[model samples]
Target: MRVDGLQDLATITRQLREQRERAEAEEKARREAAARLEAERQLFSRAVGQVHPLTDRNLAELPTTPPEPLPLQHWLDEERVLMESISDDFDVSSLLDTDDQLSFRRPGIGVEITRRLRSGHWSIQRQLDLHGLRVDEAREALGEFIRHAHKLGVRCVRVVHGKGLGSPGKSPVLKGRVQSWLVQKKEVLAFVQARPIDGGAGALLVLLQPARSA
Candidate 1:
């Protein structure tokens, strides 16, 4: 009976030692984890420096989309006005000077200008061909071309009305109308029949007024 009692005491002592060792190991691990956490906090603070959170009042909400654009209504209105300004009914016979080659000069412009234009004195800087376009299309295209050329400070240009060889009964349809249109435009200073080498009777040499300084 004494021997069994001693063996029981030995077992109890061994169990107590194992429990104490386990408790110490757990405490060591907790300390190591706490040290690592403290080191990480110090490193983050050093890297980032100090920061302040933004207040809600300082924030701005960005728009998801942009504003709508403007329509080209004004340009269309100007085009309509331009179309109405020129007319085929305007008589140009009185305005043209009777010479070997027909020519026109705006009133107040010297006759020498028309003579020079007829003689190809000014270099042709631009040209517009109304060969295949209908009457209305030709007028609109001619108006835009003249305006654009004058705006760019072009002094000389050519307008090819195609000599009417292909028209009904072989008559030039756009020639007289084109002359009337040119006379109506204030930008035209003078215009004369092109020389034989420059489309001959099929075209007119036109001189434009110098663009006004802005």
Candidate 2:
């Protein structure tokens, strides 16, 4: 008799939960559909609108990082190097004049040196340590240079035979020999040591006079 009529509260509660879940799922689906429709509308409007080419002017939807500025010292060094390169090719130093007392010379010597310098009687300073040739070999090479320079009737010339301060103890060989050979040469007008920037004492600035009109 007790089992004849029975009602389960758990079954009733389970049915109610399913109905609420279904309603919530339907609401969520509607919201998703509305969002998708809005996105489609926006895309269609953009397609109809004039498209903008990428430019530096505006960045409404993009993120960008700023570039780093160049360092001051590096920028200055580059500028100096560029000026030096131009000077090497164009001989711009010839146009400049320094009027310091130390730089003053006899009017006659000034005129001569300026004329020769303007006429390209100069050579850039260079190190010959890499060659590592013996004194005899260097003497031979120097003789060849002298011959060639004399043949050219070059009034003035510079030879950048480097300062040899290598090893524990040794007098620089090429430097002395070069000076001696120039002294012995009858054709040599005068020779003087060069300034540091010009090649220092390692190089000699030799002057000649048009190979004696022969």
lDDT of 1: 0.90
List candidate 2 segments past 4 Å from native: 1-131, 167-170, 212-214
State the lDDT of candidate 1 residue by residue for 15-87, as single tens digits. 9999999999999999999999999989988899997876766768888897776668988988767665788
Best by lDDT: 1
lDDT of 2 by residue, 1-214 (tens): 2333236666676888999999999999999999999998899777788776677766476447866776999989778544432111223222223432112122245656744543446652222221377756765565556556776777666766557676336555566556555554545555555666667656666665465565
Native-to-model Cα distance after best TM-score fit, residue 173 in candidate 1, in Å: 0.5
Error of 1 at 17 (Å): 55
Clashing pairs in 2: none
Instruction: Evaluate model 2: give its TM-score.
Output: 0.38
Model 2 lDDT, residue 58, Cα: 69
Worst 10 residues of 1 by lDDT: 1-10
